[model samples]
Target chain A: MSSDVKRLSLILLFSPFALWIVLLILLPHIGMVALSLREKVAPRVYEFGFGNYIDFINEPIYWNTLLRTGSMSLLVTALALLIGFPVAYYIAKIAGKRSRGALFLMCLIPLWVSDLIRAFGWILLLRETGVISSFLIWTGMTDHGIEFLYNDVTVIIGLVYTVILFMIVPLVSTLDGMGDDMIEAGYNLGGNSLTVLRRIIIPYAMPGIVAGCIVVFMLTAGSYLTPILLGGKNSSWFTEQIYDQFITRFNWESGAAFGFLLLAFTSFVVWLGLRLSGQSLTNTVART
Target chain B: MARANTSKALLFGYQAYIVAFFVFLAAPLVAAGTFAFNDSLFPSLPWQGFTLDWFFNDTEPKLGMFHDRRLLRGLYYSFVIALMVSTLSVAVGTTNAFLFVRREFPYKNFFYILMIVPLVIPGVILGISILVLASNVANTADDRFGIELEFLRPGLFLVVLGQFSFITTITSLVITARLRKCDLSLEEAAYNLGAGRARVLFTITLPFLRPAMIASGIVAFLVSFENFNTTLFLVGSESPLTITMYDRMAKVGSTPVLNAVSFFLMVGSGLLALISVVVQRPAPSE
Candidate 1:
């Protein structure tokens, strides 16, 4: 086809989906942001004002929950990287080829399960009388099961478990794309493993590290199901508040405001994650 | 230089820890699946005996692991809802792919960002918005038109709609990525050769997108099957398989049956994913 005609055809083909995208998704999100400045009425009515944002900023619960959620997500991301990097490195670089695929697949089995099921399973495993407790008791570590569930431990565990795969896969893909030949090249130059790692491996794996961190971090931060299911009554997370505002309370304006806050928090963290890790948010998004 | 060797030991320790962590992370899931087959009614430990009876067993009150009706109903509902979600998402996604690749409408970047935003938004928020919107619609419709839309009244259709909001984005993104690889010029060439846009799409572009579409479909199904926050608000007295399992784990507090459901889902989805991997063959060389 001729260039002009092709361009014209492209224009023709794209119009409807583009319009739908704009209308359905873009408008709703923009509407959400717009609604954040308003006040809720009897039901669905939005009274235009800055009251919602004022309430949002003034509330200590919002700030504290928001801060804790962000920090928790960050902690989970860091923990996942610490935990997953070696496994990814081993499978991608050091492991024997015959066993590598099997091991990696085994690592991934949990990822395919539903988040709800996993959360429930975690509760069962971590409940004071549950399987994990039983194991602890049997080991004579304590006569009673340790208080693991409905605390910070279970929430952290749940978050880390859910998002760890995100961290590992990106790191694996980046490492595999790089291959391990560079390490040998560094070693041939009389450098030790640490030197090679610092000088060679880290630079190549930077993209993966950044990509993995952002993907996992954002997921953990925005998550509601994990914290709700595992955190129990005392271990409240902010997304639960947001969910309650929208669902049980039937407060749309407040819900919209809260959601907008969540969005901003996510975007800011994503931007920070990219900057700190030295990769673009675009890169991280694609990796996931 | 001497200190650097310590780093190696540390790395080794970290590696060992990771392997242990993998076991830690994965043990519960494996236990859940394994315990499902246990003849004992307990979720953990104390196996009465090895038996396939759980898979085929029936209790008089019908609370037996295999004989539960509500669980079966939930499974049926989940599958139906998943099927609906996958079908809708695939359609929207494929069309969005066509639009993304072939057309150059106004505010393209704006639309692109909008389509991608939901990927980042938590499921909780999305579910909340849909519930708000649907309930409002249902209420207004009842008052104004006196027309009762059962689906809009927080049931299967509501769940499907809620899921479509986010899962559709997943489908579109996957399809869009594949479609980007497919040069738009071919479709134009076919058009220049006098084939209509529909023909060009169905014959050429659709085939290229088939694998991706199938993948998107499977992912959509998986997403919907496990959907919680969104489905929670939208679901009625009946529940999906996951939600049912969740309620049992939370309210009733003790049921080996929940693990049975998990095992069934784990094995089922795992097998489907395995088949997809073998068939899709991610590595082009292999």
Candidate 2:
């Protein structure tokens, strides 16, 4: 190939990537960072400063919501891992070949639908006059319908439902590659299932577990619809604050600051998770 | 003997747990689907005679989703947006896949790491960042150049762009996975047999990638269709079905008509999921 032709083909292939990464991803994020740094001194007047970040520190509600959102996301990640691991184990290690694929597909069905639909489904079943409440009344478990919406527990349940599939997919893929003989050998050495799971399985599955946890944490923390819809007035989610800043308040500076705070917090947690678990970002991201 | 019995009991309990887990997963969706056909306007309650009004009615109070003009328009807009997003994502994704797999450049690792940034960034951030940048540009244009850029406004065009940003990562990953496994010997043979580069790409490379492209295209379409967080910030006067549904759910509360819409989305997406699974499944036989 001639030099010009080679150069042309190379540019053709690289230009799309350049336009996508540079124009879309890098520039917008940099713009957001710049927006966050702006301090509105007067009407249609602005200067670069840390006023927005300082404001976040000064307001207890703002920082508290950030803390609450972060901790809640951590809780959701723990819950998803706890709930998903056993199911993944079943589908990976215990199920027959034909049933394995079937079971795996079942896990994915809920994910294919929109999160709005999933949240809506929970509403139909959990509202005061909803199905589960009415069923409780009929079964004489309670005389009156109970309002299950707009609470912390309800929000957690909704989040767990939304993110558990992510945990399970990675978990199952990791476990499927493990040999049955490993488990058999653990048993042969008089180790119980718990010991084997703790000593052998957990360490083996660390990469996947960390990957799943990272994805779930980022998703749960960043999630807007679930917390907003299910938690309602009580949500107090940081994303809600960001939304208020941007849309309701039309304060893009503070919104941008809050957005960065979220990105930074989530990134720190993801970094810590990778560090503790000794998993590379590339490998973890590959599994996802 | 006691140990064996205990283990057997544990197995039984484990099976029961699995059953319960699936029930938990399916409860909400099943309830939503059931209430769609319920006779009452409210989504829940005692069975008020089976009726198709939620799906078919077009009267004063019981307007079905099909008859709801706003919802239908939202659905149309969603389709068009998803179509554009999936196409752009797949095209750029394929280009990136080729670049990553077949070429060597300086800072390739840096670019590879940069590519993963979109996948981890929250959807809300992605939406707002683009919004901020576009607004800044628009303001600058209006202030100095005395020009208006409608496309940069919070509209369907921006919505498509925002979705394509992250979706391209997924399609790129899928195509790269397939492209890595492609045998280069076949390409070499084609080159030796008097075939040009473009011809080889069109005939061999593209055909090899056809399955991954189709699969990722379906995934891209569905992801864009279901997207809400990013779309919410970018949407203007027009809304997609998810956004519209969110408005009704948040503002007006639940109606059986919304339940009807949920039913249709469930089925449509279920079929798409099934198709992708079937297409990606490895063929049988040794």
Candidate 3:
């Protein structure tokens, strides 16, 4: 092909993808950033200012909810890590070949369903007249059906349950690469199980751990459905605040500001997680 | 001897833990699936006689979910949106994968990373951003060019756009992974044989990419069909299956029909998951 034709073909092939990235991803974020800076001055008028961000800083309710959401997300990440690590270890290291595939499949299947359906499953199991409450009552554990839904505890459980697979998938892949001989070698060398786990296993899995934690933290922090459905009125999830601002109040400026704040907050948390875990973001994301 | 016994005990304990974990993971799904046949109006216990009323009932008192117009409409909308989004995503994603993997350009790494940002961004935030951006564009066009883009208004088109914006990234990544493993020699040999660039692409490159394209297309469709967070903000009047399901669960007390929906989804996705595992399974000799 001639150079001009080659160049033209390159542009032709590249423009759509380039336009997609620029128009859809980059421009919208730029729009959001611009929207975040402005404040509504009058009807149908928006003026550039930091007033929207200032409102977030000044309102204790807003920042408090953000902090609460962040902390709750942290808790969920930790719990998912706790529950997921052992299962991942079992599947990756201990299970026989056939059982390994089956176990992994069992973990993978739940993730295929929508988060809404998964949250609904939790509601069916935890509601006032739901299965767990009914089981407790029938077993004489309670006099009447207990309302187990619509609490922070329920929200945390739902969040952990929802994101645990994210944690496990990474951990399993990471652990699957680890050799059992290492563990056996550590035992033979008189290292206790805990010592080996702390020194060898944990270090080897740090990339996976960081990746899983980042994903779980981000998902939990920004999650709207599980918190709203399972936590009900008390669920002060920050994404709900963003939703309320955008959809409910029609305050695009405030919503844009909150959206940026969430992006910043989650990004910072992820960076901090990587820093603490001594994992590079590129490596962690690659593992994921 | 003592160490061996202790390790054996630990193995047993870990085995029990795994069993308990599976139970924890599976119990909620089992509970939900159970109510699909419960014949009870509510999804909760007190098992009414086992019946398929939720799946097939046509009468007024307890019409099956499939017989419900609103739900069927939602399902129709979901499928249509999924179809559009998957087609668009696959086309864009396949092209981008070729560009990223085969061709080099300035700021390629930067654009690649930028594309990945959408994947990690919360779907709710992504929806809001696109909604804001598209609405602004529509307003600007009306003010300046007097052209009202009806598609920009929240609807199936917007939903498809919202979903495609992020899902394309996933599709591209899938294809890119496959492309990385593909041998480029075959294409080079085709070119050496006097095959034109387009011919080489069609006859060699595309055939090699068919599996990745199909797989990613299926994934894109599934992701779009089940999307709620992004779709919720962008959906103007038409509620997809997920949004409809959420509405029923939240506003109206969900019935066994919802459980029936969940059952069908589980079965469908379960089969897909099984198929994927089987397809991905390594050869026995290997």
| Top candidate, metric lDDT | 2
Rank the models by DockQ, top first: 2, 3, 1
lDDT of 1 by residue, B207-229 (tens): 87888888889888887888786
Best candidate, DockQ: 2
Q: Please tell me which model should have the higher DockQ, number 1 or number 2.
A: 2
Taken over the whole model, the C-alpha lDDT of each candidate is 0.77, 0.91, 0.86
Write the number of the candidate with greater TM-score, choosing between 1 and 2. 2
Residues B1-286 of candidate 3: C-alpha lDDT, one tens digit per residue: 9989998998999999999988988877888788999977788788888999988899866878789888889889988998899899989888888788878789887777766667778888888889989999999999999999988989888899899998998888878877787788988898889999889888888877777787778778888988888888899898899998888877777888888888988898787666655544445874
The C-alpha local distance difference test score for the whole of candidate 3 amounts to: 0.86
Ranking by lDDT: 2, 3, 1
How many clashing pairs in candidate 1? 2
Among residues 3 or more apart in sequence or in different chains, the pairs in candidate 3 whose N, CA or C atoms overlap within 3 Å are none
Native contact recovery (fnat) for each candidate is 0.39, 0.73, 0.61
Tens digits of per-residue lDDT for model 2, B1-286: 9989998999999999999999999999998888999998789889898888888788859998889898899899999999999999999999999999998889988888788778888899999999999998999999999999988999999999999999999899899989998999999999999999889999999988888899899999999999998999999987988998888877778999888998999899889888888877766851
Q: Show where candidate 3 strays beyond 4 Å.
A: A1-9, B189-196, B281-286
Model 3: per-residue Cα lDDT over A1-288, one tens digit each:
688986887797798888887887888888998999998889988788999999999999999999999999999999999999999998998889988988998998888788888888898889889888989999999989899898889899989998999999989999999989999998899998799999899999988998788778888887889999898877888999999998899898999999999988888888787787788755675444
Model 3: fraction of the reference interface contacts it also forms: 0.61
TM-score for chain B of all predictions: 0.87, 0.96, 0.92
